[model samples]
Target: MRSVSRRSLLRGGALGVAAVTVAGCAEQEPRQAQRLAAEPPDPETMLIRQLIAGKERTVALYSSADSDRLTPFRQRHEAHLAELRRRLPRESGSASPASSAGAQADPSASPSGAATAGSQISVRDLRDMERKAAALRPRQLDGVSPALAQLIASIGACEAAHALALSRSL
Candidate 1:
C-alpha cells in the first residue's frame, strides 16, 4: 500500500469539507417579489407602506431643507425607503395607504401621514420613527428564516441608529 503523508491527507480533507460547506450555503433566492404581489397587503404591510411614504417625503423635504444637519439624515431616510421597499412586493411598494387612513381617522384635517409621534414632526420625527422600528426588532426573528430575520433586524437597527444621530443633530 502506498503511504500517504498525514499533513497531505488532512489538507485534502479540509479542502473537500470547505467546498461542500460553500455549496450547501448557495441556495437560490425565491422570487418573493412575485409571491408578495399575489397577496393582499396585511395590516402590518399597510403600516410599512405608510412608513415608506413618510420616508419618501422626508427625503424630498430634507433635500431642499436649509438645515445642514438634516441633509445626511434625509439621505439615510431615502436609503431606508429603498431598503423597506425591498422587503415588500414591487406593486404595493408605491402605495400611500397611510394618507387615506389618516384622513379617515380625522375628517376635519388633511391626512398628514408624515406626521410623527410628536406634536409636530421636524427632524425629531426621524428619532420617533427609529424608536418605532426598534420595537419591531424582536419580531424580526419570529417565524422567519434566520437570514431574512437578520436582515430585518439590521435594517431596523440602522433606522434606529439614524434616528439617534438625527436627534443629536437637532
Candidate 2:
C-alpha cells in the first residue's frame, strides 16, 4: 500500500472535523424541538383551559335542544368562555383548549341523536354535566393564583346555579 501524504492526511482530518460539527448541530435541533414541545403549561393556564373546555361541552350539549328554552343557558356558557379567555395571557395562542375538546365532546354529547333529536334536551344529562363541572372547580383551586382562585370560585357558583336551574326544568 502506498503511504499517505501529510497534506492528504490533514485534508481528511479537516473533513472529519467538519462532519462531526455538522452532526452535532443536527442532533441539537431535535433536542431543542423536544424541549419546546414538552414544556408544561402553567397551573393557572391549565385550570383555565380545563374550565373553558367544560363550558364548551356545556354549550355543545345545548346545540340540539329547544332554542327558546336553552338559548339563554347557552349564552351564559359563552359569556363564561369569553371571561376565561380574557383572563388568559395575551401571549397565549388563539387556539383555545376548548376547540380541541369541542371536537371530541360535541360528537359524544348526543351519540345516538336519540336524546338530542327531540325538541327538548335531557335535563338530567345537562344537570349531571353541570354538577361535574362545578365539582371540578374546588379541586382546580389548588396551586392557582389568588385572582384565578376567585374567578374559579365564581364560575363554580355559576355552575351550581345552572345545575339547580336545570333541576327545576325537570
Candidate 3:
C-alpha cells in the first residue's frame, strides 16, 4: 500500500476546495443577477415616479380647460414634468407615463381619469390640488438627496403660489 504524505493530502484538499468554490460561484452568478433584476426601485426613483404621475395629471387637468388663464399654469407643469423626467435614473426606465393624456381635452375622457365627467375641473379643484401638493412636499423631503429636496421645495413653493393665484382668479 502506498503511503500518502500529510503535505500531499493537504495540497489535494486545498485544490478540491478551490475547485468547489469556483464551481459554486459560477452557479450563483446567474441567480445573483436575477435577484438584482427583481429588486424594487430605490426610494428616490419611486418618489420621482409619483411626482411625474401627479404632474401629468395636473397638466391634463389644465389642458381640459379652455381658459387662456390656465395656459401658463399648464406650461409650468409641463416644465416641471420635464425636469422630473431628467432627474429619473436612466437605468430605471425613464419612460414618462402616457404623455397622450396631456393632449386630452378633458381628463375625465381619458382612461384612469383624474376627475369624473360633467364635474369639470374648476379653479377650486386646481387650487385644492396645488394646496395638497404643496403640503405634501415637506413630508417628501426626508430620505431624498439634497438637490432633489431643494427642487421639491421650490416646486412646493410654486404650487403654493399657484394655489394663491388660482384663489385670486376666482
Candidate 4:
C-alpha cells in the first residue's frame, strides 16, 4: 500500500475533530434549552399558595385581637392553614410566608407604623376581610381540582358565616 501523505493525514485529522465538535455542540443545545426553560406553576398550586397566605394573615389578625370570643375562629383558620400546607407541592413547600404574601407590611399595620403593638384590628375590618375572601372563593374555584374546589367552598362558607356572626356580635 502506498504510504499516507502528511498533508492528507492532517486534513483527515482536522475533519474528524470538526465532526466531534459539531456533534458535541448539538448534544449540549438541548441541555442548555432545558436548563433555561422553566415551567410556570399550575393554577391549583397558585391558589393553594394564596389561600395559605390569606389564612396566615387572618390568623395574625386574630392573634392581634384581645377578644377571647375570637379564639375558635382563629383555631379554624389555623386548621385551614394546615390543610393548605398539606396540599402544597413538595418543591414549593419551602416557600416562606413573606415570599408568598409579598414584601408588603402587615394588613393591620398603619402606613406610618404608628399602630402600637396593643392596637386591635376592628371587628368591622375583620368582617370586611371575611366578606371579601368569601366572595373571591367562587372565582378561585374555576380552575382548581375537585378536592381543592370542595375545600375552598367549605372555607368560603365558613368565612361567610364568620362575617355574619361578626356583624351580629358588633
- Highest-scoring model, lDDT: 3
Sorted by TM-score (best first), the order is: 3, 4, 2, 1
Q: Which is better, 1 or 3, measured by TM-score?
A: 3
- lDDT for model 4, please: 0.75
TM-score of 2: 0.65
Q: Positional deviation of 111 in candidate 3, in angstroms? A: 16
Winner on lDDT (1 vs 4):
4
Model 3 quality (TM-score):
0.68
**Residue by residue across 82-156, what tens digits does model 4's lDDT show?**
887788888754356665674233232221233333567877777777787777778878878899999989988
- What is the per-residue lDDT of model 3 for residues 1-170, given as tens digits with 9 covering 90 to 100? 99999999999999999999999999999999899769977978777877887777777778877689899988988888899889988877655576323332221113233553334677777887788878888888998999999998999899899989999998
Candidate 2 segments whose C-alpha is farther than 4 A from its true place:
1-34, 94-121
lDDT of 1 by residue, 1-170 (tens): 99999999999999999988876665322445456656767654554555555555556555544577667766766776677666655555354444323311211111234663333456655556556656656664566556556766776677678767767877
Query: Can you write out model 2's per-residue Cα lDDT over 1-170, one digit (the tens) per residue?
Result: 99999999999999999999999999999998798659866766666666666566567668756567878878988888788878876654634753436323322223232454344557787777677777767877888899989987887798789889988988
Model 3 ranges off by over 4 Å:
1-37, 99-119
Write down the lDDT that model 2 would get: 0.71
TM-score of each: 0.45, 0.65, 0.68, 0.66
